[model samples]
Target: MYFTPALLAAVATVIGLATATPVPEPQGIAAGSIELCTGQYLQGRCTTITTPTGTCVEFPRGFHNDVSSVSGLEGWNCNLYHDDHCTSASYYVQGEQDTLPTDNFNSVICTPPP
Candidate 1:
């Protein structure tokens, strides 16, 4: 293959742009119970979700650590901005029952676990 300086520069620019892209942050909290949503087994149950606008919402402790997986909640809808920045979001309860308040509210406010 013939290697051209311009082609190489173009490829470099493309790679740079892709790497420079930022991920969306969480914007709101999603409510749900274990019975309601079911699927892959989570390490620590997702007690609550913190949605911080223009930034990634850090999971409490357990649950999916990766933003991509967490964002993939079936009922949960994510409004991602630049990269993975979450502008608006909501969680849909799969099962039925009373809405229990999240226990780790402080975790979301004080120190959001990465």
Candidate 2:
């Protein structure tokens, strides 16, 4: 195929746009009960709980009152639950700091309630 400069530019533009677009962030954890185990000053803490839908929740940095505590830690140990039932759980540290616990740490894959 004979490629023209304009055609190449158009292709490049399309590729750039496709890659640059960011993925939409998941919606924050739904309404559910959280069991958190946090230490004073946000140190030496571990959290484990079950979401209302059996999503298997975990507490990285042990559930921080704010985002700063888990800002640095990533891939800590934690468990998840949904609807008061144990589903899939794993250990993961904090990925980013956010007011919401779910937003602060990267949640491991877990089996949601059937």
lDDT of 2 at 55: 48
For 1-114, candidate 1 gives per-residue lDDT tens digits of 897999999999899888956779885643422221112332223343544322354443333222221223334333322222233333332222233222211111111222
List, in order, the clash count of every candidate structure. Answer: 16, 18
Give the least accurate 10-residue stretch of model 2, judged by summed lDDT.
66-75
Q: What TM-score fits each model?
A: 0.22, 0.24
On residues 14-106, what C-alpha lDDT tens digit does candidate 2 reach at each position?
998888667899987543333343433344454444443324444454343322223322333333222222343433333332333342333
